[model samples]
Target: MPELPEVEVVRAGLAPAVTGATVISAEVRDPRALKRHLPLGADGLPGDDGLGGHGVRLPFEAGVARAADFERRVTGLVLDAPRRRGKFMWIPVERGAGDESQPGSVPIPLVERGARDESKPDQLALLAHLGMSGQMLLRAHDAPDDRHVRIRLWIEHPAHGELRLDFADQRLFGSLALDRLLPAPDGIDLIPGQALHIARDPLDPAFDDAGFLLALRRRGVGVKKLLLDQTLVSGVGNIYADEALWRARIHPETPGTAIGPRKARELLSALRDVFTQALAEGGTSFDAQYVNVNGQAGYFAHSLNAYGRQGAPCPRCGRPIVRESFMNRGSHFCPKCQQLR
Candidate 1:
């Protein structure tokens, strides 16, 4: 799956093309893409899979929803700015004029508001999860569809003209949904209600350094595990985790509680550096499966220092980088510089 940097690249590429564009039409070519949207007003029903108005069972799990309603709700809405948290990306939408408030009502900003004012209406959003092998591409309206294309949106933009937004996923794990945007608990502006539990990524302006340090000390899990925990910190996947560990000279298996405040700060700094560098390089794409909006592979793979470089000499010291089996994943680091506790 694409991590923060890769997802951010897609988000940045998509913002200009899709933002402020009105949805001319939306087509869901595959049922799997609509798995995350619940049927309208189906949340009040009891049971895990209660039958919806459409006679289909409501998908109760995260990222699972009734497909028919998902398609119907998003057809005519205008897509606002695209935003991302961790690997998740979403576009806020405005209802058609008929659904708007009466004249003289306070107009709401298209972007999520900073305050948690329940009296203000929540904005509707189109959420997307790019699970493994998923790609969002902007193509010409007349272009041919890719083999794995699951959803396509025809958008009309005043400046850019008409364009087609394609969501392609070779594997069926990725999905798109219509969701409500609720204020973040920390008073940060809107985030999908379904994604309320996800912690702020290091790149987010609202990331709390003091809060993260306190949580890290309390978790007592392995450093790599804590790094991978979406609740503690978002967007540091296996590759970046390894790179950050190597850069910080900390062993991946070291307990989070065991890391001192100075070391923890160092680790966070390393994480930011790695993320910024990877994003500049377009993210670490080893193959064609991970690409930007233009379908071009990232060059960050060439800049990898630790991950997938088992047995290669460490850039810091002359010692060889070694790979260790870790929680069903391989962690690469310099055994000499990043000694096990």
Candidate 2:
């Protein structure tokens, strides 16, 4: 359940550790960890590279080399960078698919940071959305279980040499996206919704404004559901959504379309405010469940406006914060402030 800010923290934790290293080994660990990846035994090894006709790319050759290239070429490598676009991360593929016939999902290719773009087949991009309960981390293999570790990466570099990275989640609902990451036919292109189809971005300082209003202009979905939709805005999860709505003095059950611009803008501003505040509060821990990649429970839960604070008093109005089930999701709101008119 790690959202944008939490994910950004993970990315920051990794830059120093694995950014410049070669991926000596990459293991999925849990087959269900990856959506498109075929099931595997305990270690979650890649199944016969779907392209048996052609030889398979060895782990280190393809993996480590690729990781090095990614650090070299790709700028702004961060957890916030690889985000969900309607349930998947849109990674830019360097080349075309490996097989082309039964093209497996490899969004970002190994040669991302390298200067090798002779043909499409030579490189490719991968899109992976760490499903729920799926967490990602970067640390020395000796690093103790700071949190739930799912995937592990053994990275080697000439400068830093080596380290083991881990991605873990207890519920295991997190996912990863691997689009045919390589860029497509020049002039030939993917449909509009192919990449992250973000609606309103409260985070973007220069984020689109009119576009955000338009998305909220007409939609019968409840506010909670609307905010949860990555298409509407990438990265807002249950925690931030609840907090933002509560801050806007809006009820979670209020229908999206019924909201006016004033309410929407307040809600938007609250989104940024809540994320900033939550990142400060340790990002809302569910239980002993979602500790950071470092295995520390998020400090954000203490500052929560609505989530996990059932029957708690609303800080702003002193009214009791209410919790109810909607769309089968438990939502928290303040009755006095967020009236359902």
Candidate 3:
């Protein structure tokens, strides 16, 4: 799965190509790609006849029908600048004045103003989750589709002409949904309601450093476990957790309450540093599936200190890195530098 850095890289790469562009056509080749938006009724399956009672229709139905609905709602809307929080990315859609009869008349402005009025419900958003093997690729209009391409969109831009945006997911766990934008507590006008529970990543401007440190000291769970909790702190996955802990000289098994204010502050600083370094390196890519929009692998994997280098020499203390079973996953750390209390 792509972490904060990798997702941010994708978001940054896509902003230029899709922002303000009108979606000419939207197609979902796989019904599973929209499973998240499809709500299951009491029967554990889609309602009878695909349309539920009282004119309420389930979003998840026959692939062709769902695709047609998606096309109807999003065909002529202008996709605003994409925004990201942790591993989730969404593009707000604006009902432009562009003529539906004419295919590419909408002009995408270079300057991006923030969301319009929060009270007015004139906008819809497209939420994308890049599951384990999901990739969002921007291809030429004439490019061939990859075997895993699940959703393809024809976007029209004033400067770039027509471009094909492809969402390819090999595992079928990734999804795309059309959701309503709700006003966030922090005054951000365009946060999806489903993502309101997710805490902000450290790189976000609204991230609360002091508040996180205080909460970290209060949580009685293991330090690494707390780090992995999305509610406590978003975007710190297993690999980054080990790296950040190793950098802070804190053991993965240490109790969160045992960490005092100073060590807590150090851990927080190390986390920010780790995320910043990984972002600079374009994130750690150990396999071909994890790549930027251009299909380039990240270089941060080579710079890792403790994540996958089990039995390798630790950079700080020269001790062989140890791997331990944790929550059905393996955790790598330097035994000498990060001793369990």
Q: What is the per-residue lDDT of model 2 for residues 110-145, given as tens digits with 9 covering 90 to 100?
A: 332346463543322334444445555556657676
TM-score of each: 0.86, 0.70, 0.85
lDDT of 3: 0.79
| Tens digit per residue, CA lDDT, model 3, 119-155 | 5443558888887777889989998777688888899
Off by over 4 Å in 3: 38-65, 98-119
Model 1: residues with Cα > 4 Å off, grouped in runs = 41-65, 98-120
Root-mean-square deviation of Cα positions for candidate 2 versus the true structure, in angstroms: 9.0
User: How high a TM-score does candidate 2 get?
Assistant: 0.70
The whole-model C-alpha lDDT of candidate 1 against the native structure comes to 0.81
lDDT of 1 by residue, 271-322 (tens): 9999999999999888777888888888899999899999999988989999
Candidates in descending lDDT order? 1, 3, 2
Best by lDDT: 1
> How far out, in Å, is residue 181 in model 2?
2.5
Q: Best by TM-score, which number?
A: 1
